[model samples]
Target: MRIFVIDSDPSFQGATVNVTVLPYEPYWDETVEGNTTRYSGVNYNLLATLCQALNFTFRRIPTREWDEVAHLVEIRKSFMTTVIYGVLPERLQRWDFTFIFEHAGLYFAMPTPVIRPSWLSFYYPLGGYVWLAILVSTLAVCIALIQVMVNEDMEKVKNAMCTEQMQ
Candidate 1:
């Protein structure tokens, strides 16, 4: 990600605060395989911890104009650990956090796995049929009990009417 910061001096004596620009690079594994893989699979926590160790604050900028710059730029493969700047208090500044890329920009930043249609996880192997059969059987038994109760209630009502007519 490209970062730009400008510092201006309050006094207009033809003198400026001259700020040194520092670049920060965050690391993530490129070998992720599946779409279901969680974002935590990438070592983001470790990256944050490493940033804390260094005095510089880390911030993630959006990957804008990536399509135009991706071919021209070659991202460094080696891990970087360097310090550049004037000194500040250890506890004063905190690392700012943001998503590496926008949801649409993620496609350019990393190769995502193609999603596949989902099926029942339990419908695999021989043992799966046993559970299916058990569920069906339980449903059938409940249905049969309901029918029996209806029939018994109808028979009791018929018997009561017949006895009343004989009286």
Candidate 2:
């Protein structure tokens, strides 16, 4: 279990902000592999977005709380955890936002996470799919270009033969 500390921006003066944390299981999510892993949600973004939307400030604090999870064996005597600190204008507490957490590490800090729309869950596998499509498209274009060049050369040879025969 990771501990995320979320706070609203002080600039709001008296606005109350509602912050909710959602935990996700990384191992179970197939998107956790390769480039897709980057898009997965961590504790920090939830707070940051809320702060930004409310014109507040945010920070992330990581901590280890594996003991809090039920029936899980705490094999590691020590582990790292993270917390999100956000400051929002005091007026927006009425809006509700859900923050998601998956695995012990912060995915946002990593380079490979996919870019996703703010409202959608960061863990969606779109990045991997997009990358795969791009790779396939590039390969197909290369193959087509090679075929076009071969066809052009064959046409040149046919024209040369026809000219020689006419002469």
Each prediction's total of clashing residue pairs, residues at least 3 apart in sequence or on different chains, is: 0, 27
TM per candidate comes to: 0.24, 0.26
Candidate 2 residue spans exceeding 4 A from truth: 1-126
- Candidate 2 yields a Cα-based lDDT of 0.47
Q: Tens-digit lDDT track for model 1 on 9-33? A: 3222432211111223332322346
Task: Give one digit per residue, the lDDT tens place, for model 2 in 61-108.
Answer: 222343332112123221212233232454135222243343244345
On lDDT, the candidate that comes out on top is 2
User: CA lDDT of 140 in candidate 2?
Assistant: 100
Write down the RMSD of candidate 1 (Cα, Å).
Answer: 16.9
